[model samples]
Target: MPPNLALEIKCRESERQALLSFKQSLVYRYDILSSWTTQAKANDDCCNWIGVGCSNNITGGDYHITRLDLHNTGLMGEIGSSLTQLSHLTYLDLSSNEFDQIFLEDVASLINLNYLNLSYNMLRGPIPQSLGQLSNLEYLNLQFNFLEGEVSEVHFSKLKNLKALDLSDNFLRNCTLGPYFPRWLRTQNFSVLDIAGNMISDKIPRWFWNNLSPNLLFLDVSYNFIKGKIPNLSLKFKTMPVIILGVNEFEGTIPPFLFGAQNLDLSGNKFSDISSLCEVNYSSPLYLLDICGNQIFGHLPRCWNRMLNLASLSLAYNYFSGKIPHSLSNLTRLKSLNLRKNHFSGEFPSWFNFTDLIVLDVVDNNFSGNLPSWIGLRLPNLVRLLLKSNNFHGNLPLSLCNLRRIEVLDISQNYNISGTIPTCIYKFDALTKTLNASEVPDYLKDLVMMWKGKETLIHGRNLQLQRSIDLSCNRLTGEIPNKITELVGLVVLNLSRNELTGQIPYNIGQLQSLDFLDPSRNNLCGENQDRLIVQDLLFAISSGFIIGFWGIFGSLLLFKRWRLAYFKFLRNIIEKPL
Candidate 1:
């Protein structure tokens, strides 16, 4: 045998071994890889697909699979141990799929792996300790899964190079760090850390914030059972873009440092006093500040002029009182302003101008006087206007018709206006559906019926872009307009609590797109028990004819009484004839 022939044979054998190893690495546990056949593999150009990566150069011209990403592909089945054959694999992403009981013991074999993502899946069971063997791993994301078990220091302390970690939206229980924070986590300079929506219960350790890297910018620990006073930061970083600690059982006054931060969201908590926020230097560029659903009390900070770049301001469901500052008009860039369910009192701010405002929700406030007519005209971009349960007066602003982009307008319970609804109000082409007015005149009722016959009402059917109107409590009187049926895109119609007296047009039932309909507490009387019914027969009888019928019946009864008296008189006269 020649030496060259023997060498060729050896080379062929090595190639065969490489191919077999590559095929084995593709298989997983629970027969999951059975559906991923060779034909399907060929469709992806021999595994050089979008979600797969290889390191052929490092493995001496052999295909060394490194990365496997199968996110959002509707994949199902348990992970297989065959995946361990890819010793050089580094990155693996299987998020937003249906993988259940994801075995992790086999993952420890991939010693050279770096990034791993398994979020938004049905994976369950305790995390494997073998995961710590990945010494060079950097990022690990396992959010939005059903994995349960106590998260111990042993599970995380081994990953020394982890820079970005997200274990949010899980059922992990009892995540208490005894006295001090994990020393291994403190060593790594993580920039993004999210452990939100978990069952972790314990006082937020001080060392957790103290040891955070100066470069940390985003930190989310929300939706947990963690309680205790919020730690005060050293203010070392120049910019902390996002800090979300909402939906927790945290109690105590919010630290003053929160007001100075750029994006502070401490909503859904038990903070009692936020007046300290008013003292924060507003020189910083704070874009979003949401502190809704808290026990905070005190007047809104009048220093709103300093937050020039503020975009969203939500302080709803609080005990805040005092006149809404007219200075809020200075927040010209404001897009959303929600101060609903608060104890705010005083006249509606005349200078309140939100040119860029998309959502202006001030419902359930102690506001008085006519709604600002300029609200619709000035804020053309307004999408939702909820001013219910207030002391607003005057007729519906005709200028509100200028809100061509308005989708929702709920102003029920403000019972101080009296007048026929203007016919021109229906001209808002952008109007999808409106609330029943409290004081509908006869003419407006007729107009509504007329509009219902138009064919152009079927334009906007999508719920996202549809418009709806609600006018449940008013002094409107007249037959319900059939034209209301013309609003083919109407999703909700609430005309309850009005003095409207008339028959509800049968055509109203024709509104196929109507999802909600309420006409309660109205004078409407009709055959439809759910609708108001008007007495057409009573209206048809003329006044002269009704008077004639009463006169005839009275004459008949009088004649009978006279006959009895005459008979008695005759009897007395005959007896005295002598």
Candidate 2:
């Protein structure tokens, strides 16, 4: 072998040994890198490790570690400093681990690192300023950590190659970035920037709209103490696809240009006047919009019908009044619609174009008129149907029983809805077993379950345990059908304040999973009354026998004359009373 080649091989072996130190620091129950053993008989090449990647350096003609991805490995323990020894590493991802107290300065030696993700860990302490030396970094994510202290501009001043930066869900209250929008962000050309769920209290600076990089595609600064009116952008964000500014204190009208964003979440803000939202460009392709919990008033703009790509729309808890625009049916891709706690009046539109809707919540509205049965026929995929606290009248639609995937059905508080509860409620498949639609988002599938008479919102975990039926406070008069017992998985049943009469179903005890039942103020009677009367008669007979026996025995023992007189009186009455 050539002298240079022999030395290169020796260096590779030594660097391979350095990797073992990092492996020892982590506790992997599944042993994701079980191949990383030290036995001579085992595969000694570090390149063969489960999450390690290697490539040959053309100049050095030796293999070097270039990537180390151990995300979601169930690994725990502090990220040991030995990882810095891999000087040739360009990609390092230790996300979704239990690593704690990870000091960024320890990994500063890896100057070649172009991608670093330490997100979703228990990392604490301040970010090390030495990270700024990694000029080659293109992606850096330190989100969802316990990190504290300031993160000044100097920490990222030299990262000219950075295209994406995420430091959300961290304790950056003392960070020098903001009490206002970070001015330093203007110097960087970030395509993706997320500083949400932090303690950044600041007004969105005026320059933010004018100076946004044309290359920017995604921006999020939600869940902060940001306050002020959003200024209109002169330069149209033609290429930007997402902008999330929800859960903030931003007031005033929404910028007209913002309607062009494909994915927007401006919920939980104090913004008012949605007149500009009605003027979105015809060609705009908005998909997801969550402007709920805002003070925005006025009717929905007619332009909403043009958003053909719209999927989810949440306008709940707003002051918007007037009938739902007929144009909404034009959004054929609509999957979820929430207009709860609004003043939308008039009869609900009978026809709808969005047949694939999964969630529809229109609770606490002034909607009067028969709930169009088309809701069940048109939206067959309904998972959560919340229509409570409305003026909807007439008999409950029997077609609603066809919604097999429904997990929650709340139609209570509509006094005019007078009819017997549907017997086909047991056919709802989602209530029969725990739903396993993990493929969909959590917001799309959820139900308000009643456990021990307390209502609780449930989603994802333990959600399948919720099966409720609320038809109380109405004028409905009829006996609860015995078929209701078929819904053995029912967790809550409320038929109170209704005129329902007749004996309670004999099979009521079959609902073993039932946690709550409210039949009060109704004419319903219990079928167990006969059994209870028999029990009372048996108790009375037993008490009488015990008293008679004790009295006769005591008198015979203490008063001989009284006992004889009592016996004689009983014999005379038995012989002559008839």
Candidate 3:
């Protein structure tokens, strides 16, 4: 067709009316589809409207709408059936909406759809099997939705051109995907497959791997109950894949076939050994390796120097013991290291000088001795330092105050740790100012923290502006440092269950952002005692009251300072001004 002739073509009036009817059914946050109006002459052309794509299939025939992209437009309500009238549509995107599930059946009538995305919506109930009628659909995304019921092979019986499928974060069942090996997928070659966070609870059949698409570049089956060990076979890949099989029940030695992946996560499984890590031939440069919460035990492999490209590594919640291999220092690009809740013993690695390091979590380990004083000097970029529940015994190193960007500092529950709270603690500027969301690293985005004796997972957006310090359940004995109150952005400050004495900081009230402050069980008392919540007050005095209230009060009366404070409190209660 001539260029001038194409410009002269106008969309069929029927399709324009259909789109206008569709808009009547929508409840949008803003008038994003304001161009869909039909009052003006140019606006009457549906093909010229925003997000609508049109093309002339005939030399002189009328143009037809072939695409409708409305994802993330904040449109919600009952999706109108008028969309079924646009039979020429080869591409359609209606994701991230809150529309009702009344149009899926109507959508099946359009056999020309080659790309369909209805993810992150309120579409509920079983997917209509008639959807398979669209044999040209090459990509389908139904993730993060409320769709339910068992999906059989018939649901995709005619989708022979399908190349990518995502049904993650749904309420689908194990049987929804069918037998040990979905033989229905033997013919199609997919590049990306994600079925995570579902009810998948069967061992991956060996035959399934043989049929796996060689073109696959991304696979995520995490957060399921898949069982059995991966057969020891040297599988190959055409691309550097990013595979995630975390939070499953796969046990035994780490398989070598997985080494070909550039980013791999096998955490929260029953795997007992990882010697294969050192034994395998390097197939690709690994960037991220997370095997946390597994049964892998004994000394870490000393061959970490082989993967110098490693940036993020996590072996937390495992049984691994013995000193961390010194070869870890060879990974100069390391940015995050999480060895939390393990039996790994020895002093914290003082030699690691990775300037790009952002997060270091070694909580609940047997690591003992004074924390290496060179931490701040070695890793100046440290943002979250969680060293709680260890045998670390010594004064809180003042050098730690040099971590200027630190947001969360939890050196709590180390029984033998004793010292006056460092006055230089306020140097952590991240704790005093509202940190921009961009300043938080990707590794600390899902960082966890203990708040008020309960474990809480604080996400990055909230954590960026929230600062915390937990030094509870330790033997620290001294007056709480007055400089601590300078951190105006501090949200959670816990110093409970310690033997600290003297008054609380006089400027404690200055922490305007303080939400959960616990100073219970400490001998410290002051006019700012009202800062502690009622629950903490009960926790502080209930134990002594149960043990022997009179005895405890009698002992306090023997001290002149305690006696005067007690009488003053009693007099204030009795001499009511009213």
Best by lDDT: 3
Ten-residue region with minimum lDDT total, candidate 1: 443-452
Q: What is the C-alpha lDDT of each candidate?
A: 0.63, 0.74, 0.76
Who wins the TM-score comparison?
3
Compared with the true structure, what per-residue lDDT tens digits does model 2 show for residues 1-578? 66554323223666677778888777777958787777433245667678888888889777888899999998888776887789999999999888886657878879999999999898888899899899999999997776767777778888988889988666443453566666667667777899775556988777667767666689888767899998877456667469898889989988877777878889999989777766665656678988889998778887676578878998898988898888887888888999988998889886664678877888888989987877778888887778888999998788888888876677888888988787887787766654444323654554454443466655434343445677767888778887777665554567767888887787665443322234465776775645544544564476447645654565444442343345435545755845
Candidate order (lDDT): 3, 2, 1
Candidate 1 per-residue lDDT, tens place, 471-525, comes to: 6566555556655556544544556666666766566654333222344557665
- Model 2 lDDT on a 0 to 1 scale: 0.74
Candidate 3 TM-score, C-alpha based? 0.82
Error of 2 at 534 (Å): 22
Off by over 4 Å in 2: 1-14, 24-27, 34-49, 55-63, 101-103, 171-178, 211-217, 234-240, 434-440, 446-456, 510-520, 527-578
Worst 10 residues of 3 by lDDT: 555-564
Quote the lDDT for 369 in model 1. Answer: 82
The true-versus-predicted C-alpha distance at residue 353 of model 1, in Å, is: 1.3
